[model samples]
Target chain A: MRYKVTIAYDGTDFAGFQMQPNERTVEGVLTKIVNKIAKNPGKRIQIFGSGRTDAGVHALGQVVHFDMNTQMNEDNMLHALNSMMPLDMSVKKVEIVSEDFHARFTTHGKRYMYRLSLGEFVDPFKRRYTGHWKFPIDIKLIKAAIKDLEGTHDFSSFVAAGSTVKSNVRTIYEASVRFDDATQEIVFEFYGNGFLYNMVRIMVAVLIEIGSKRRPVDDIPRLFQVLDRNEARGTAPASGLYLKKVYY
Target chain B: MRYKVTIAYDGTDFAGFQMQPNERTVEGVLTKIVNKIAKNPGKRIQIFGSGRTDAGVHALGQVVHFDMNTQMNEDNMLHALNSMMPLDMSVKKVEIVSEDFHARFTTHGKRYMYRLSLGEFVDPFKRRYTGHWKFPIDIKLIKAAIKDLEGTHDFSSFVAAGSTVKSNVRTIYEASVRFDDATQEIVFEFYGNGFLYNMVRIMVAVLIEIGSKRRPVDDIPRLFQVLDRNEARGTAPASGLYLKKVYY
Candidate 1:
């Protein structure tokens, strides 16, 4: 039986979503427990994730798929997984799906959100969750700059160096920024067909710079035309990013 | 000169507020930093807190007082202390106080808060910040039970066992419970002249039981009459408790 599961994690202690030799990872931890429940004889039961989130990047609706020969119910599987997993990660929902559903290849859209704290000093309780911004910012500038990111465009300037992808074209369906006055935090949300490695962080960095008047708000369009990674000056910290959802 | 400082700390990593031999404590950490800033030789410089909070309990407005011979400005002192202290703790405010000011002895009232999550399975991100309740709860019942706890009363039933305090009489100035729908968390706030050891946790436990129908809503009156620690039955976990403020 093929199963689809939605999970949420704090991601503070995780090396990343990808598996490495000895580092603790979301994929490694889930695979170990999935293999245990599968009871596969000397064979590894791999769990497929929608995409990879960098170290210290949280996830609220990360989807995964795995196969098992056991005839256990979905409820039983969810209960077992939540019981065995560490306190920082949890299985929010589980469903038996067709073998045709692939967690990664079948994905059609993705949503990512970033949070920033506007404070002179970092908050003790929020240090692990929110990225701190020390400089004053004009929200109108960020909002104006973000509007230029919508629609299809070649995001070559936003991609990190040493890229291997053949195409830099991606369609951003929506981009919005909201300021929460009570918490003194700003949240940026993006929904797109796909995003390249470090794309959201790079865009956030550029937006922050524009809001702070270090760069002109009109620079985003020129960077897209230049197709130079060096033109994009900053990358936001990983702690602020969250994989909000994956749509199939 | 006498210095009074207000600090906020994420107490998840500390053993407790009081100093213990070979233990990582909030007091010990603050004292070490204070002595370093004071530059006192041979004799140790101690920082006195308003009260001791149990291990894993958080603080948003904990106050402390200490003496130093240096004549540095308040801004420099605040910056130096925040820079030297661990990331889990930060100085919020600092001021040059009178010689007669004392953190503990001069305290007048306090405000404490407890957080509870009404989720079947604990939320991964909120695990460190909120207490989980597996059973169904009625906020109305808890509110009814809480009304009897207001006003001046002898709260002997709420004190923990092995307590050695001379008086159990305290004045409850106000109490409130607010449920945040977006976060699915309940926040309980209490303002009182003083609190005994584990008093807030014990009272919260009783209230939770009443809300969940394990006990009658009228149990508060009877428990006060009993005047026994055994009447409280349970104590909420330390993670959900927060020392919100210390009024002087």
Candidate 2:
């Protein structure tokens, strides 16, 4: 039987999602704990994920599926795994799913949130989880900047140059910028069919630059039309981005 | 001239309060930053605190004072020192006080807060600032245990052994416990004339053990009366405690 697990992680201490030989990775840790709980200590389990989140990139709805022959109930397995897992990661929800259910292909839409702490002092408590930008940014300018990117468009300007997507089109259902005074965090939320490699980060960079008055808000549309990666601003750090939700 | 400063810090990365050679100490960082900001770089500044905070112990109002050259304006020095200091250590307030104002001697009351995450899974985001305790604890029992220590008494039973306190008799102003569900944190707030070494941690240890039903809530008063260090519960981790305020 296969089980689908929804997990959340801090991602500060991890190298990335993929399992490396020696470095600490989220997938590697999850696999190890899953194997240990299944009573197959050395068995290689093929864990499938919805997507690969970069190093220092966090996730709340990171869906994964794995098959096992163990008889341990989901509650027991969850408790056992949580006890062995480091404090940086936690299994939020776990359930039995159809053996044919694919975590990657079955997803419908996903939301990503990029958080930037804009204050005099970067919150030391949240230094690892948030990106700090010291410049004063205009909220109105950022709100107007991302408006042009709301509809379907060729998003080559937002995608990383190393992205392997044959088609660069993505339809954003919603996009907005808001500031939280309590947390002193500026959040960018985007709902899309999917995101390109580093797409959210690149878009965030453009929005921040626009908010800082370094770039015109109206120029965002023209930059996308040009389809030149050099025309876009630099990509934001991975720590600021989080996979917030996925609707299947 | 001397300046009184109120300090706040995230203690996860610090070794301890006192300055040490070739180590990352809170006092060491403050000294270095002050030297960098002051004109007299050769002057070894004295940072007098109410007391020493152990490694991994945080503070919101750890009071300190230092004498500097008369040429340095109090406000300018405060701002300059904070600017040059790291993100973790912050100067919350600074004032030019009476020459007799000593951080340790003039202090009248002090408050400490202990934060505990009493859930099955500790949030990855709050791992550094919170102490995770998965075992279920009874708040009523904990409150009853605290009630037994709400007045002036010899806290030798609660204070760690070999603590260099000249006297064990300290007056406690208030001792209370509250839980916040949204943050999943149990906060223990205590105000006293002063504290012995590891006193709050040891008190929290006894309270937590009582709350967990491992020890009886009524046993707390007997421990205080007995004045035996080994009769009480073990000391809680230092990471859970914070110097919340120091009053003068």
Candidate 3:
């Protein structure tokens, strides 16, 4: 039977989401526990995630699916997985799904968020979860620049150099930047049909530059005209990004 | 010159606030950096804190005082200390003060906060900062129980067994419990002139029992009447406690 699970993880110690030969990855740990629970001994079971989150990136609602030959129910499976998983990772939900349900292929949309701390000093408690930007930011300029990013556009300029996707066209349903006064954090939220590799991080980098007045606010629309990766700013760090949700 | 400094620390890795011969402590690290910045190699400078926080307890506004024979100004000293301190510890402010200003003495009051996650599952991000309790809690019962804890009272029952205090009488200015629906957390705030070795922890433990309906709501007054060291419940863990502020 096939099962679907929603998980949350603190990715500070993980290499990435993909399974590698010797590195500690999210898929590597999940597969190990699932195989052990299935009592497969020598056989390895495959678990597929919605997409690969880069190293040091966190997740709140990452989805995955796997098949196992056992009579264990969803509650028992969740309990077993949570008991065996490390404290940094947890399976929030588990359920038996139809055999044809695929976590990646059946997804309709995805949401990602990036957090930036704008205080003069970095908060020790928030150092691991937020990107620290000590420079002063003009919120009005950031809001104006974010308006040009909503709708269907060719985001080739925002795609990283190593991404090999055939097309850079994607539809963004919503995009906005808001400052939280209590925490002194600026959060950027994006909901789209899909995202390219390092696309969100690169977009955040450009917005940061525009907010700090290092780059012109009109540069975003100009980048769309050029459609060249070199026109965009540098990619932001992975520590600030979080895969917030996956829609089926 | 004598200097007074306010600091904040995520104390997850330290043995405690006090300096020891071989343990990694907050005072040990601060003394090392302060001595290095002072350029006084063999003259070990003495530093004093308001109180010693137990291991794993965090602090948001802990005050300390130390003396140094250097021409470094306040801004330079603050920058130097923060730059040299580890990521988990930070100096919030530094200012020259009179020699008679002591962190422990000549005090007015102090405030502490304890964070409890009431959700069925612990949040992975808040694991290091909050204490997790999965049992159902009655807010009204807790509020009623907390009212009896205010004003001057002999809290011998709440002190830890090994404490050597001459008296257990302390005046509590404010005590209350509130639930935050946004984060699904219950926060307990206390303001008092002083606290015993484990007074706050033990009070929280008994309150938790009353909130969960394991103990009667009136047990607090009974314990106060008895004034026996063994009458209180077990001491709560150190992870949930935070030294919010020290007033003088």
Estimate the TM-score for candidate 1: 0.95
Regarding lDDT, does 1 or 3 come out ahead? 1
What is candidate 3's CA lDDT for residue B223? 95
Candidate 2: residue B205 lDDT (0-100): 88
Q: Tens-digit lDDT track for model 2 on A135-213?
A: 8889899998788889899998888877887999989999999998767789999999999998999899999999999
User: Model 2's lDDT to the true fold?
Assistant: 0.85
For each candidate, what TM-score against the reference?
0.95, 0.91, 0.93
Candidate 1 per-residue lDDT over residues B64-164, each given as its tens digit: 99888888889999998998989789999999999889999999899999999887788888888888898889999888888788888899999987779
Task: Provide the global lDDT of candidate 3 against the true structure.
Answer: 0.90
Off by over 4 Å in 1: A40-42, B40-42
DockQ for the candidates, in order = 0.75, 0.59, 0.56
Q: State which candidate has the highest lDDT.
A: 1
What is the C-alpha lDDT profile of model 3 across B112-207, one tens digit per residue? 999988766767788888888888889889899998999999998889988888989999999999998877788999999999997888999999
TM-score between predicted and true chain B, model 1: 0.97
Query: Higher TM-score: candidate 2 or 3?
Result: 3
- Looking at candidate 1, what is the lDDT of residue B184? 81
Which CAPRI level is candidate 1? medium
Model 2: residues >4 Å from true position, as ranges?
A: A38-43
